[model samples]
Target: MTQVTLDDWAAMPRNRDEVSHGVLVAAPLLDIRHQQAVTRLAYWLDERLPDLVALAGVELLLAEEPLTIRVPDVLVTSSTDLNVRRISPSDVRLVIEVLSDGTVRTDRVTKFSEYAEVGIEHYWIVDLDALTTRHAQRP
Candidate 1:
């Protein structure tokens, strides 16, 4: 299967795709449990952390040249770049991914390493089935 690149993915009129190492990864519709997890987390962040912006399904840029990008289930960013099309890793304060069956490997191994490598302050994973949450802080 041929996947779109970052530029093409971004330019498309409607996009629900993420780029990992310049290859577009199509995002499937989230199940109710996954959606609920994201909504609850976003609400909690909004209520408790009024200083930061909490949003669901925001595109985050990890690298420029290789064009790696991810659409976190929930992302917390400072109020600085409110209207930008895509978020830079540096601006990202926290990113949360509510896992589904298809996303287990990528979210755990690939995204875990990538988020840490970029120095994002915090990364969270919510596994509804396992009823577990993992929070990783970059050092």
Candidate 2:
């Protein structure tokens, strides 16, 4: 049980020049539409579900800390987990990743495996252009 701060991950270079563990990583920049969609979805969920009071968007989950667990799009959790600032993967009820140009492969493959490893119940990948969402669950 180790705690990895946002600063630790942020320290990972966001460009090809910067390298971590001898690996070069390029961080994906979120688009305006992605932000808007997240906000709209959160608001919509809030209106419909009272139990799910805290909906987080693109918030980092410190589960398996030092791994820099960040999820895009949307997340909905129950009141019991609301008071805590950082949440474990098991606490996450739903994870929605809105696919973007840079993230389609990572979203469809890497993240899918990670979320499942952490025991996420429901997962979704939304295709913005096609207006379709792909769903998966832990088995």
Candidate 3:
């Protein structure tokens, strides 16, 4: 198998996928509840953060050399990044991951670590199943 670079991942069609530690993986299949939760959270965040645009289902390039990329359920970024191909950690103000049955651990543990390591200022894991949200801020 060949290594997939960030440029390769970026050029691919806008499918919700992830490049994890140099391997490609499909994003969790979002159910109706998951979809609704993402939409609601984006709208709620957008209203509160006027300068940043809350976007849903956009690619976040966390790393470059090893090509770590993830598509957050909702991400808050500057309006200037609205038309960009991928939102880097520096450009992302906040990222929200809506937890589904299959992605609870990923959103909670793996992503929690990845986002922090990538320098995202704020991260929120919304667990719809548990009806709770955990917010983390980088110190």
Model 3 clashing residue pairs (backbone): none
Tens digit per residue, CA lDDT, model 2, 1-139 = 3344456656753331222232334556778997787778778877887766536444445343334456446776764746554556666777777777887887788777767766777777777787754455452
Q: Could you tell me which residue pairs clash in candidate 1?
A: none
- The 10-residue segment of model 3 with minimum total lDDT is 130-139
Highest TM-score against the true fold, candidate? 3
Stretches of model 3 off by over 4 angstroms after superposition = 132-139
lDDT of 1 by residue, 37-133 (tens): 8999899897888788899877788887677878899999885767878888888888888878788898888998999899887887777876755
Candidate with the larger lDDT of 1 and 2: 1
User: Candidates sorted by lDDT, descending order?
Assistant: 3, 1, 2
Candidates 2 and 3: which is better by TM-score? 3
At residue 23, candidate 1 shows an lDDT of 79
Those runs of model 2 whose alpha carbons end farther than 4 Å from true positions after fitting are 1-26, 62-66, 79-84, 132-139
- What CA root-mean-square deviation does each model show from the true structure? 2.2, 5.4, 1.9
The candidate with the higher TM-score, 1 or 3, is 3
- In the range 1-139, model 3's lDDT, one tens digit per residue, is 7778977886788788899877888876778988998899898888998688998988888888788899999999975847677788888888888778778788888998999887887888776756654555452
Candidate 3 global CA lDDT score: 0.83
Better of 1 and 3 by lDDT: 3
